[model samples]
Structure formats: C-alpha cells, structure tokens
Target: MYVPPAFKDDEVESIRATICSAGVANLVTATADGPIATPLPLFLDETEGEHGVLYGHLAKANPQWRSAPTGEALAIFMGPEAYVTPSWYATKQETGKVVPTWNYITVHAYGPVEFFQEPERLLEVVTRLTNIHEKSRAKPWAVSDAPAGFIASLLRGIIGVRIPVTRFEGKRKMSQNRPEADRIGVAAGLAACEKPQDREMASLIPIPA
Candidate 1:
C-alpha cells in the first residue's frame, strides 16, 4: 500500500487488467472481534458503480461472513511477481550500490461489504462466476449441466458477497526506478530464468526511451 510515485499505477485500464488477471483476491474486513480475511475468486462488474462492483461467495460455515464489519472491506488482487537479485543490476558491477528488490503488480479495492443468502441471487452469482472461468475450456461447463435439485442443495451451503468498490489502489513495481542499463539487465536476467512467471515479468519492465 506504500506505493512510491515511481511505482504508483493509476491508469484505469492497467488497474482493471491486473484485477481481472489476478483471478482470485484476499477479501479482508475489520470486525469488533478482529480482522478477518478469506481468499476468494472474485470478479469485477464494471457496469455497477463509479468504481465498479465486486462479486464472490464464501462458504456458509466461514465466520467472516457472520461477523459484523466495522468499516469498508478490502479486496487484494495480485499479479505477476518475481525476485530481482542485485546480480541482475548493472549498478552492482559499476558501483556495488544496488540491493535486491521485487517486481510485482497488485490492486486493492475498498468498499462496503454485503452478504446475502437468497437462493436466486446465489445461483446467479455462482453461475456467472463458473461461466467466466470455464469459458476457455474445450467444452465449457454450465450450471445447467447439473440437476436442479442437486445445484439448489449445493447453493444452500454458501453465501453471496457483493462490494461496490469506492476506491482502488494499484501498484506496479517493475524496475521503473532503476537506471536504464540496470532495467535492461533485469529484464534479460528474468527472461532467461526457468520460471514462466519470471519470464512473464520480464516483458512488463519498462524500456527506457
């Protein structure tokens, strides 16, 4: 959350891309007892409000839904990330002043939280969520694939969540603060690594003009 000016990501499309690509988020809420969080697969509804709405579900047994929230809820979405060794910085060879750092993208959405149990709404939320994730499959599955009674029974064990996001905090730390040579070294180093994520991160590093 302590995003420096160089790392701040305020671009609307960039923020939305990070959220959508994250696929899952950590939903957190402050309560009288304490803070509670749940890792949830959430989707953004850009049509809903000024900042858009977030939708997800939680198991009925999860106490996070039962506790009364004291303030706005926070949903954290994380994107590509990789460790950057000082060895990848040209400054390490030139002046030996560079230290290790991390490159990553993240978004934090905050808004009022609402929990609902209506079977119809629950069904709709789950169906839409399922379709979003399954659409890429060779044979995409649908809620209609299952028997009505079976689907209804399963829906009873979960509760729906909705958050009309009031604000968003996005950060993209991709070696933007480093010198051009150091950044190039980082990109090359990461691109050559075996981890696919590191290679993915390599492409996100900004190339100096």
Candidate 2:
C-alpha cells in the first residue's frame, strides 16, 4: 500500500465508506511456512475499538486459520477502479509525457487476528453476516429460516474470525495528480465508457471549480 501524498485518503468517513462498500476483503497473514491469504466477506463494526473491529469466517478445513501469524494480519478492501489511458490526458497532446495509470480506492487495515470455534459465537457471527447481506432483498432470508439442527451442523464446518483494527491506510487514486483540463478529459472519457464501473469511477475524479 505505497500511497503518494497526492493520493492519500486519511479521512475516517471516506475510509469507512470504502470498506463498507467493498463487501469483501483479502485477509493476509505471515506464517513460518509462508504468507497465506483468503478472500473473505468481512464486516466492520465501527463502534468497537479505536479504529474498528473486523468480523468474518473461514472454512474449518482452511489452513490459514490454523497457522500462527508471525505479526499483524492485513485486510485489504478494494473499491471502484478503472484504467486511465494516456490519450485521455490533455498533456499527452501538449507534451506527450503522460503515461497510463490505474485509478482506484483501497484500504489496508492491520490488526491482531483471532480465530474462534465456540458454537454460540459462530452462530451469532453467521446470523449477523447473513442479515447484513440479505437486508436489501425483497424477501430477506435468515438463519432462523433453517432448522436449528441443520444450522448448527453447518456452523461446525466453519470458524469465526475477529480483528480489532489497529490502523488503516487508505488510498484514493482518482486523477488528483492531473491538471484540471486533463482530469476533465479523463472524467469525460470514463463517463462515456460502456462499462458501468468506468462510469462509476468518472464521478470520483476531482473537477476544478
């Protein structure tokens, strides 16, 4: 997460928004064997500690949970991103010095990792995670919808994960380093793209007053 000063995003609200909107994260840890990572759907509880707390689960068979991490774990959350062509830069025509780059929003959260197997805690985690993702559905599903025995049996195959986030490094590389005219051109170009993600990224580019 090497972020230049121009692209740094230190605002708490902005960082939190990126994390929440991401819906999923890459959890990485260093082990004696090597580094291990798992893509997980994680939730942030902003009310928890100084920074926040992250919650998720992993399959019981996954070795990542069993390995002892040498240091802090990292959770990487990625937001909208798009490829910026040098052709979109006004400087390209003036001096032909511009090069292609990627514009994206990302957050790296670091903290101690905890894995638990208690059935009660696992059930609570599963129920909350399910509700969060299902709330937008027309007829939302719930853990209670399934039989207790069935849900209990399923929970046995998974382990819970908790991380009390100690720090956050957020970056928003959205053409902020470009000149006003170049940034406008990028925004226009991306907005006209057929990809919805490119169009979404267009709105994040800063426009000069």
Candidate 3:
C-alpha cells in the first residue's frame, strides 16, 4: 500500500480491530499459475504469535488449495470507504485546486499459510466459524445442529487454512492531507450521504479542534 505519511496508520491494535471487524476478506497467494485469491470470513487468534494467527477454510475442490504457494500469503481486509468530491472542498471555490479522492481503511497481513484436511482441526474450524457468524442471528445455528454423519461428510469436502501472521500493515486514508476547512467541508458532504458507509467514513475524519 502506497500510504503517505499523512495517511499512514501504524497503530497495531487499531489495525487488528479493523481486520476482525471486516465481514469478509480476500486471501491471496502467489502461485506458479499466477495469483490465486479466495474471499472468505476469517477469525483471529491473537495469542498464538507475535502478530497473530488467522483461521479460515475453503472448499477442498478449490484449486487454490491444490496449487502450491511459493511463499507467504496475503490477506486483505477492507473497511469503510467514501468518495470525496472536489465540490465538497471549500478550497474548490477559492482556487479550483481540490481533486476527488477516497477515504477508507485497509489492512494487509502477511504470513506463511498452511493448509490442512485433518477432520479434527477442520471440525473445530468449522464450528468456530459457524459460531462467529451465527451469533448475531435471531436463531443462531451450530455445527452440531446438523446430522453428525452429514456434517462429517461435509467437512471432508473442505480444508482448513491457518496463516500465522508474520507482519501486518494498515492504512487509514482519511483526508489528513486536506486543509482544515476542506476537510470539514468533505466531512459535511459525506455525513449527508444516504449510505451508512459514507456516514461512517465521515465520522472517522479527524476534525481539528
């Protein structure tokens, strides 16, 4: 990520929070057949390593798992994003100098990825992943809710992925480069947007006191 000093976000805890909050993420790997990527929901185990550990799974039939990754893999977590128009900048009236840009948060995590098909570990991964998503439902579901034989058979068709994070880089581009007046204008414009995501981004802007 090409983050300028004004846009950089080096806060480790903040970065971890962003990744955990992302509903879905892209897991990417470099392979002999170019690059392969998978979109999946992942959970973090923070106690495992200096950075942390990530857990997820993909269909056993997915070629991404079959393909051998040459080195470390990358997981991209994207957060709230909003467009900032030049018209939203107060400076546009004075010098017509403002340009459009985007404000958002992102995290790139790198680590060695290990793929496994062990029934025991896969069952654990599936159950935990199920619980994470089902926790918010009116009627939450559980891995054990399904027939034991059926669930076991289903688990056989997939593989678990563990990436022990070696490093994490985060970026929060929230209009820090803009002057105070311009930033305030942009915030006001985004705050008025109908989309919750835009309003969310607007709230992230650091307003000068």
Better of 1 and 3 by lDDT: 1
**Rank list by lDDT:** 2, 1, 3
For candidate 1, which ten residues in a row score worst on lDDT?
Answer: 200-209
Q: Candidate 3 local accuracy as lDDT?
A: 0.91
| TM-score for candidate 2 | 0.98
> Which ranges in model 3 have alpha carbons more than 4 Å from their true place?
none
lDDT of 2 at 52: 92
Using Cα atoms with residue i matched to residue i, what is each candidate's TM-score against the true structure? 0.98, 0.98, 0.96
Task: List the pairs of residues colliding in candidate 1.
Answer: none
For residues 17-36, write the lDDT of model 1, one tens digit per residue: 99989878999999999999
Which regions in candidate 1 have their CA more than 4 angstroms from the true location?
none
Tell me the lDDT of model 2 at 41.
Answer: 94
What total of clashing residue pairs does each candidate reach? Answer: 0, 0, 0
Which scores better on lDDT, 2 or 3? 2
